[model samples]
Target chain A: MNDVIICRCEGVRLSEIEQAIREGASAVPGVKKRTRAGMGPCQGRVCQRVVLQLLQQPPSEAGESPDALQRSRSPVRPTLLGDL
Target chain B: MNDACDVAVVGAGPAGLVAAIEAARAGLSVTVVDEFPWPGGRLLGQLYTDPRSHGRWDGRKISRQLAQEAGELGVRILGGATVWAVGRDLSLELSGVPVGTLRPQALLLATGAAERALPVPGWTKPGVVCVGAAQTFTNVHHVAIGRRVLVAGIDPLALSVAMEMHHAGVDVAGVVLPPVSTTSGALASPERAVARLADVADLAPNGLLRAAARLAAGKLSPLAVSALRFDLVRVGGVSIGFRTALVAVEGDGRVESATLRSVAPDGTLVGPERRIEVDAVCISAGLYPLTDLAEIAGCPMVEVEELGGLVPLHGPGLETPLERLFVAGNLTGIEGAKVAIAQGRQAGCSIARSLGRATLVSPEDAARAVSDARTSSPFRFQPRIAAGRAAMAELWQQAIARGDQSA
Candidate 1:
């Protein structure tokens, strides 16, 4: 049970993510939507890097090479829905 | 057929930026669209250029760096494109031009916020300005409104504007706050540490005297000052003053002035009516949730009296009542940039995991993100926002009725 709640706005706990993963969640996005981990006020600006690091880590290793993780996308910020 | 991405993140602000970057990192094809010619949305336009003088954050540099990073990630970035409407088909009309429809498996709406206006006498005067507009002018355009300016409202942004004005060598008359204390009455506890960090005393006197002295010192370039008596009124920690200028604030297709009797601390107007004169009136009145797109798309929205108005109701994963659609950023509630970004990342990760493309983050990581997001936001629920909303609605109704009578 990690004390660090990554997405404060939504009150998401990291342990919840681990639990969801243990329960069969596969990807970061899936885990996030289900857990409401990063859907808070800040919108993932601060948590993205942490999530990325987690995704890049090998499931078995402490600090595995980046090859195991998926590639991240761009625009790393919120845009207006009307402007999309 | 239109160009497609695995995710289409709109509004390039904190939320959109994180969403695009995370989705792309996860090997999802992503396209981030923005109405502005550049990224960073409001930050690019205001915070970056005129960053807080005392803060370590360099808004402009950060935005530029973020833009570069997004480019490096191979995310297609479109700027100077206005997204007018989102259709049921999940297609968007960019500007007036019709672009091909995209069926992104996931969509993130991070469209930030819009400034709320208060109706008052002479508000339409040329000197009156939206605190944000003044910020954009100073930060983005490198322009100043006047040698001396009066900034109203108690929002942090208003204080930031006053700071920017000081930096730009403009005099800040003072910040005006309504008599009501916190936006949320006692019931609402501070949601974030930042919300608890405000020192009202520090912001008040300094903001007032600094602006007044600057004006008295004639630090600004020569501008016309008509025969108007400047009255500086200090309320609580807030200070307000009037300047003599028949100027009107008109641009971007809206008139920005009105006449109303002054109001008391109890929200009652004082006197029959007294015209307050000001060269430039800046309203830091606050913000309203922009839920038009979400509403049109049939996302369930709840009017959280504490959270402003019309916030979409979503459980974990940014999921609303509508399946397969996710919302991130201020659309949920108006917190700040940092929170919006964290939410975007979580949304991206959640969507990716749901799609079976990436592994879910550990509970540790998720917890850290949540805590950090909470700490970064400073806004609390305020009843004044609701009151302001009601007052504005009444004003609008009265205006419409008057218009009808005239017709």
Candidate 2:
């Protein structure tokens, strides 16, 4: 099967996310760091929940734990560099 | 716009507008901020008939009424304004139309919900979109998504949006089930999807369609599944492809055609895949609470499957762990718009009480209104909402006991 795009903003593929999960990415932030799924302009608004569901898949040696959201920082909305 | 107000309601949807109205009525200066160009949030796209009242309930009209009421009560609604950053001290840094920071005494986050994504092979294509997004374009913006559309996934939202599109003179090619996957759950199976569809069968546009839906939902459900496996059923002139799953979409830059395959009663792919030419494909994966703002504000979030997803811990009065931060509407959980309005009223009253002010409606009364609205809600998005609410209350109690304090 073709690798479906998971992160629309960054064009992260599902295979990449699966590889990240195989490489001990148990949570959204971990996946974001490894695959940049939630590191796009929308900042995970579109792909965060999808990544969370993907992380909840079983048989993970990373051990089960509650999911955590990425810490939201300043300029939550897209702002121009001059605006800052 | 004023730099600050007594209360800042972020959304301007049914919940935020009602909350602002109640708070302003209590003599608290209220300001509302919304990212949308208009004040009405998701309500702008809603147009349905009340199964009880048998009258059309246009969401855009209701939104205008609420927005007007809030304005009469002296609420400042900053449409097209985005709260880019929220501070622990109830300070909101906004952009767009009103480009400045405003510090309010209390903050109410009614950020609402977003559609869940059901990604297929060609979902990223230009003509592919969510059912709600299509609804917004067709009903709100008066823009047609496509000349002919194939809607995948059989849910209340999908069915309703299909009907709305049909009424708007769009050729709704068919409604099919999504590909069988872990995330698809009940919708993956034909039998389960039929049962779930039967729950909201009354919402069908015409009586004949409603009768068919009820029959399919009732003792005839098994027979309906068999029929679906064999052939398609036309409901209200729109083809209902039962036992059929959309496996993949094939297109060049835009949606061109979708691959449909027959599924067994157990939701396993059975027959050969067939391609149907379609300009648009609307995936209805369902909805989840938009908790980005709550997460940003550092509110404690708990996962409640029945509520659709992770929601902030809030009391019956919609008060969060943060002293003056409250959440209402879909942000708390996925419920109908009426329940959101009731919750808004309750949150407004709670905010008034927390601020030690007198209000027209007591918090208890507002709470009762919420219960009333919940019971009377035509569409119960989640069947186990009561259970979700109970679990949330327990979580709130546990969080309090553990002293999980937040800023």
Candidate 3:
């Protein structure tokens, strides 16, 4: 489970997220900042829900489910800069 | 395609297609956009018997019917078009189509639900896929996941897809529970998993058991679980393993075998790990509403546990807090395709009414259709869907009272 890949895009492992949580990174963004789990191209679509569940685990630091992970920025899908 | 239209629906699923049909029939120029290369969304691979009608609900047939009707109504459906963002002014930024942006008088977001992932050890292996993807590949694309496949996760979708794969000539090794973790909660417990199976017992592929299950009628009597112990329930030759947990799927490059362990009824891992030789692993964690577009549209969302997670708040009429912005289908909450189609009709009429256009059917009638469909659907993804909808309606009233609907 420790070696299991949590974020496929960033290759973030389960151990990395556990480490992030242990270091006071309660919310998804905190974990993203520390371990870059959701910063990848798919933009956390695949992994944020798992991270949210991890936060609500026993010894939870999430408190109250941490406000729906930040609203996704523009270009939700991969788009070329040239298109702009 | 025209850069603008009377209505622009963000998904081409059952809900979006139905909404487009209604709006277009009302003489509104409608365009429906979908990210998939085809019009039908998740409605593609569904195949189940409606206990009420004793008839089959073939997803592929229904999707084609809806798409054909929409086309006849002059609704332009752009497949492979993704709406990347919705600007504050409600202008849609799109890709994979000739038109880069579309400005519409009204926008309906029927963005359907996405399957929840259950991450197991060695899940990233090549042959591991979500249960929904397995269903699609087998039923729609006519592709086999593997000759011998083991499924992890005992839910309605997983059970149904396992049966579907068996029908498609795949050796479905076994349908087992995912390992219990902080997230898996009741899913890992044999009793709880059996109770959930009892809910959809009518859909059992076995004729004798299906009749017995129908007699039980969605009741959770202890006798039901005891009579059909998970190990004893053979869903069309596919073994159901409630006490067994699929801990991992390991292979060199693709799936070659899976590791299973015994799970006690009290939800503890006991005994030694057992290895099962299988070529593929399909995991079904569950499903949640796909709400990215709703959030991007600036629609206020509320997390209703009954509705299967965060959904855009909307009234019974399917009108959201944003003016001229509407939502339907799984985007509002997780329900069957029938409920989604009904919600689409309601949203279409509501959109037409909002624009001061006469609709073929009144929004009130359409809303009744939504409720009727919800009540009659055999599959209950979320049992408390009605309660979830009522909560959402209450929240919508609160939002309206707070003057949030003017946007």
Candidate 4:
């Protein structure tokens, strides 16, 4: 409970996200690029929502809402080879 | 069986099966598309004796019955159809290499509910899964989820799955409620917690009732006392760690153990933290109706926490704001299988009434079908569910009315 691990797949902590935001990560993609929070096996299925909640605060609230930011990505599911 | 169908039903769960049956019986050409390789949805995996009657409910039988009825009525069932997207134009984007299109006169979304992710620390591990996933592995695939399991919750899903796992000879370490101190501590609310615990007794009340009858001058029945224990409830016959909240899951490569810390009702840590070594963890909060297809179809949605989350606003007959696009079952709200079946019948009749040129299923007949199917089960949670639905509908109406005024 003390040390909360948000991104379980990659073992990324909330502190890491906060640090990424402090390090000039503006939006979800920026935080993702810096922290690798949503680039795990589940493909952000679990952490995307958590990342959205984390990005709702100050400094990261510059551009579009977190809802719109999360929705901007395509291929929502793990696309199979046949789907291509 | 063609690309053009009178009615297209998505997700061949109980609701979709019922909807397809009703529509096809009413002489509408029906097409049921499901992502599963087979029908039955979650019902296939829920193999347990009904707590009320102590009679084993073969969910497969009824599912097969509905599937048979749909087939008999000439309903084309595409078991492995993965609908990538659904459009307001009543056309569907198929899965895998751009398959053919489906343009039905009407669409029924029986997409049902997804197991709500209980995002705790270490949940993204390999062996940590939801109860529904555990049940599917055991019941559908006949594969054991794990040799030893830790279930994190005490609701109907947790209790039932624990019992099922125990029956399958999988060692159920315990069923524990999430710590009240946690952020997702809705169980700390007296009303919600009481309702949840009362539901435990309501599940297997016969043992409680018989024990009560044997009580000496209204004394606490020891038999009832032990039977109502978290460990003893629902023939689970496993350990139950009360006041325990899963804080983290620890494992080397796969899931190895879960950390359970006890907390008081006021969100205060009360006791020592205990670590239960286990291979699998079945974490469950509740089920939320999947509304992606409904949203893709541009149906107006409102967040209803009672139904597990955001749900499409619809009329009594399951017709969404976007007409010709109906939703049934848990896709509307997370009630239960019986309610879903009734709503599916209602949707089928409604779709037939609106879309069919010469129909056999009338509105009155549909209404009767829904009513008849709704009250047969002595389900105790229906009252709370009804209240939740009423509140949700009220909120939806208020939102709509405000939009009218502003417009």
Candidate 5:
């Protein structure tokens, strides 16, 4: 899982997110700023929730509350200026 | 350009197209809007052969026919226009680029459903994608998602996608389904949960899969004997939908393998977890209604467990509480395209009647269309969805009553 890349856009791995959490990135945005997981073309549609889990729990525990997962973000579609 | 039209329908999918066509037939100036360049929502990406009609009712063909009919009716299509906001006055805010204020006398929000991904440990890997995304990349873009793939989940969508991938020469190792007992947060009450389970059971591929498996084992029934005598690959390939549950996916860099376990009907894990190596993993857990536009337009919505999520509350006529505002298709529920089309036609005719046109879709035609949709589609979840929707509508009324007392 450490070698496996979770954020395809940022090229970030699971370990990097965990390391950022270990280094005091306790929230989704904090991990995004610390580890570059959500700063991608997709704008974190894919990785932010996974980042949240890594931020909230230690790696070995491997547990995150699906029921307690945060709400889906707004403006569902990605907006590129040129496309607009 | 004129700022007002007889009707402006947002979304150009199956539901939207049908609504626009029906509205035009009623002698209305109809405008159909969508964010995509194409008209069909899920239809263009679907390629499943109808099991009942022996491959006659093609997905792509039906979608093409709807788009063509809409065009022939002089329906205007506005592609790539994203709706930013909609006022009570029916004034729409475009994405800061399209120069138009759509002030239609009637508005139909046919905005369709989107994929609902259930979380898995390795779901975020590079090669992991929703099954709909796989279908879109292959059918629409002429791009192969992966050379070898493992699809996870059960439903017509999963099997249809696996079949499509197999047709495209991708090695679809197998499709995996979770245990029937595995429920989503969408199911709230026990009664609704049990009803949805029955609906899933009625549509489950076990009978077909078992029949195919017996054919594989050389104990084929007379009807199955012919299917085996003709082609064993198709039967065997589709039969994989049974006998598996996805526990987790183990991967490195990209999707390297998916961990699966066999499960029984009683929700008991039957075998040791096994990992099958594959380049990609696609999950078709199911879809929830896409209701952002309906929400932004301020339509009252309630969580219908059977329909999969919170959906706009509407009367049987598909008219929202908002005046002259209507909704159809998956925006109301997750009942597939056939039902969506029927609801669209119903909404269109309802809108036309409100506008004082009498003969757009006759009463008999409207009844027939809805009846056909409820029973004709390959997938059958109408009973569960109908009950859930009715309960939601009742809940809405109770809330309104409470609000009135409070005010």
Candidate 6:
């Protein structure tokens, strides 16, 4: 197993995310708040694919089709803070 | 205090900033409302560390300067105020509550753009993130997200984040795309981008070496690998884990884990479910115009196939169907900052002229200048943007379906 960085803005690696999962971050937003992954400049535009790949399959059934999940709020690209 | 202005600009990005500045300079009592504590909109505090050199700048500084000049011209700037809804009468709701209405002689919608969400299996996972979010965290708060990160998409914003992460001492794994080159226009020519990357490598040998090293190191750490059980493949020194066995993405609002049926390339269900752990995930699918306010204000909008959804169909004057309501910036389309500024300035001049303000430059002259300015902007990524929108629609549909099934 190699360390995979899923979100570049927050510097979150797959390993650390899995660790967070092991440590009981049961949901995406939960892990995000704890690790600060999707909370960066481009929002979550960079590491989303990796997150989906890593979090594939729950503990029970492997063949269960992955369900599509939606973000509670849409992420917008960061503008100049002053401009906002 | 109940005050009147010749022009009321909503938002303070390049569009609103320029609008207020130009209009006030033209002797209009301009008032600009922004949701942030200061001006600059998304450009301020958005971190973009130079990929070739980890250089930083406070985006707010530029906006501050513009604000200063506008202030000197007597433009009323209202920061820390949210314009929730804009009405046809040019009345604005502040923070979902009713505020005093300002029926300015003219109004400009510089509402900018918002990020488009693309749904994917496990996209709701805990570590999944957005490119804009990551930039905000790093640039605004001076916080680092994670040690290793993976960027998706190929937009300049996506590349900028990867470069920023690398410069911020974060290990950027690699950028992933949906088996297609979405960006195909002036945004960045594929050949030119590759050449620029080469230039970046030449300029920042260390960044290039680190990117090379990360690419070469196939697979993530054993802990992440074992926990996630992702199928890994090495490509050009980068370890790419393809989740072929994705069945369904599940989470309680926030993403916890996804269900995999079979790995891709060949669809075969992997028996027994396994969870891949991650801290954050960033998604940069595409961008959409923030046209809600424009729509509310009764602007004559048309769906531009090449420019994503609902863009204002303004003629040379930047005037909407509403005589006093003008639209500019990304609210019309996802053009670059320079174009947005130019459009805003032109709109300001047009509004000023309509108010009979005599100036050295005529509205036609300003329009010509705006047209010239727009010609040089590097925002011709219509194809890629369309693809990104399509992808986002797919994701949204999938999510809705999943939500219905779960319910």
Interface RMSD of each: 19.2, 4.3, 3.6, 6.1, 8.3, 12.4
Span of 10 residues, lowest total lDDT, candidate 3 chain B: B211-220
- Place model 3 in a CAPRI quality band: acceptable
* lDDT, candidate 3, A2-78, per-residue tens: 87888888999989899999999877888899999988898888888888788865433311232746567778889
Model 2 residue A38 CA deviation (Å) reads 1.2
Choose the strongest candidate by TM-score: 2
Comparing 2 with 6 on lDDT, the higher-scoring candidate is: 2
Task: Give lDDT for model 4.
Answer: 0.67
Candidate 1: lDDT of B13? Answer: 80
Local accuracy of candidate 3 as per-residue lDDT tens digits, B1-407: 43888999999999999999999888899989999998889889887777788798888899999999999999999998888889776778888788888899999999888888777888888999999899889988999999999988876778778878888899999988886766566668766776666666755533433533443344334345444433435544777776788888889998999999878766678789989999999998888888888888888777777887778888878888888999999888888888998988988898888878899897678878888997787767886787888888777777779888885
Query: How do these models rank on DockQ, best leading?
Result: 3, 2, 4, 5, 6, 1
What docking tier does model 1 reach? incorrect
lDDT of 1 by residue, B180-250 (tens): 21121221111111122132222222344334333433422113122223434443344543221111233
For candidate 5, state the interface root-mean-square deviation in angstroms to 1 decimal: 8.3
Count clashing residue pairs in model 6. Answer: 100
lDDT of 5 by residue, B342-399 (tens): 8889888988887888755675688578757866565653446767666756765665
Candidate 3 or 1, higher lDDT: 3
What does the lDDT read for residue B132 in candidate 5?
87
lDDT of 1 by residue, A1-83 (tens): 15345455576655676676677656557667678655654444434334533453333331122222222222223444543
Span of 10 residues, lowest total lDDT, candidate 1 chain B: B184-193
**Cand 4, B chain, TM:** 0.85
Local accuracy of candidate 4 as per-residue lDDT tens digits, B1-407: 22788899988999999889888877889989888878888778755556556786677777888898889989988887777667668777666323456889999989887765566666767898888888888778877788899988756566667777887899988877653433354643322433454543434323322221223112223223322223222232666554456777889888999887764443355567779889998887666677667777777666555555567777666777676988898887776677778788889888887874545666677666655554444333333565557765676566557662111
Candidate 5 local Cα displacement, residue A8, angstroms:
10
- Position B145, candidate 6: lDDT: 67
Q: Which segments of candidate 1 are over 4 A away from where they belong?
A: A1-84, B45-55, B96-98, B178-277, B378-407
Fraction of native A-B contacts kept, per candidate: 0.01, 0.36, 0.42, 0.08, 0.00, 0.00
Q: Could you give candidate 4's per-residue lDDT for residues A1-84 as a string of tens digits?
A: 434666777888777887887898766687788888878765565665456545654323211122323332223345565553
* Tens digits of lDDT, candidate 2, B1-407: 43878999999999999999999988999999999988888889888777777888789999999999999988988888878788878788888864488889999999999888877888899999899999999999899899989999876778788888898998898989986764455567887777776765755544434655686777448556755535477777888777789998898899999999988877888869999988999999888998777877878777787887778888778999999999999998898898999999999999887888988887778888999998877777876898888888888777778887453
Error of 4 at B74 (Å): 0.9
